[model samples]
Target: MKRGVLLVAHGTRVPAGVLAATCFAEGVANRLKAQNPLWENVLCRLAFLEISTPDIYAVATQMYQQEGIRELYILPLLLLSAGHALADLPRIIDDIQRDCPHLRVRMSSPLNDHERLVKIYQQHIHDALQQESGIDALLFVNRGSSYPHSYRIFQQIVQQTSASFPDLKKTSAFFAGLGAGLSRAFHRLEKSGVRECLVLPHLLFPGRLSAQLDRQLKEWAMGHAHLHFRSAPLLGESDELMDVYAKQIVLFSLRRAVQTV
Candidate 1:
């Protein structure tokens, strides 16, 4: 069977965001190619759900018609199992299945609540701080979702992260939905006598939201020189993350093979 891998990301208006996603997909494809000969023949393509062109359906159709790919696997590059993962993605997949009945397609779960991801965040925080001591609080900023479960998972992650560093005081805020916004969270922290803060954005890639947050933090920092503020980089391209994707693909393929047998 001619196999293809379609990586789906929540598209962003920022050109850099699109480039980052593309780079990540390319890196994963290269890693998969080198790791196993079975993936040598597999084609890898990138697609977006919104604010970007050439969506999943378009890419899958191209692979089927032009590349003669009969089997396709979709991997969502989302960090949480929010509305997009729970509803929008499934609806799109159903449409694709109806459109291409001959193609065998499978979609794995998102990268939410994954142990590796938590480890990655921890590493990022440690690396970003880099011996900076006397931090009053660690503020985690997340792109909030309307789904209650998403908020629950986000809180769980915060709790886990806080547990990892019992010495540092950790708090969380959202970019959109429930709880306080960035400004409000920071204000509360300031009121509580937090003079030094380490802000970590729980985002996959640098996008509009990340850029906005960076701008806000910079402005806030400039205004309040007394309050030391630092922001960590987003979770960009990494070998370990690519390995996760490759493992998911391999596992899904094995399960599919068993079901076929």
Candidate 2:
């Protein structure tokens, strides 16, 4: 039975975002072929949930109709098990499976509190601070979600990550929310007397949001001359992150394959 790998991401209109997500998908595809025996002859491709070309439904249909893929593995390039990952993707998968009953589809869990992610987050903190040492605060930034469960899961992840450093104070603010947004987050930080801090954008790739974040931080920094805010790099084409994704997917898919055998 032929197999296909579909890598899905929350797409964006920005060229940079598209490039970053696509490049990561391509790299993972190449790595999957070279590294794993199961994926050696597999067709690995990228599809977006929205905005960009080749939406998940379209791509999945094409994979089955053209590629003759009877079995499929879906790797969601999302960070949280929020609206997109938890609901939208699954709905589409259900439809796909309904339409093609013979097409066996399996999806991987979101990168929620993965051990490797914690290590990556720590590395970002170190890279952002460099020799500048202190128990300075940390500002965790993301696109944010409205779902209560999403909020709880993310807060838990933040709490666990912040515990990595010695007495490192941290705050999480969303780019989408108005009340608990970045500006309001700054107000909270001010009360806590956070002088120096590292702003980590919890993102898989660079996009309009990250660029906007950089600009906003610069502007905010200029207004508050007394404070120091540094923005860390997004979880992009780094070897570490890619390896984590590929390893996790391979292990899960291979296990499923064995179970069926």
What are the lDDT figures for the candidates, one per model?
Answer: 0.81, 0.80
Candidate 2 C-alpha lDDT tens digits along 92-177: 99889888778989888766336677788888787766767753899888788877777776677677778877566788889873
Candidate 1 — worst ten consecutive residues by lDDT sum? 252-261
Clashes of each: 0, 0
lDDT of 1 by residue, 1-261 (tens): 889988898899898999888888888788888898989878999999998877988998888889988888888888888888778888887887788878888887777336777777787667756767677688989999888888888888787776778777788889897777888887878778788788878887778899899898888888887778787767765668877777777777777632120
Candidate with top TM-score is 1
Q: How high is the lDDT of residue 169 in model 2?
A: 76
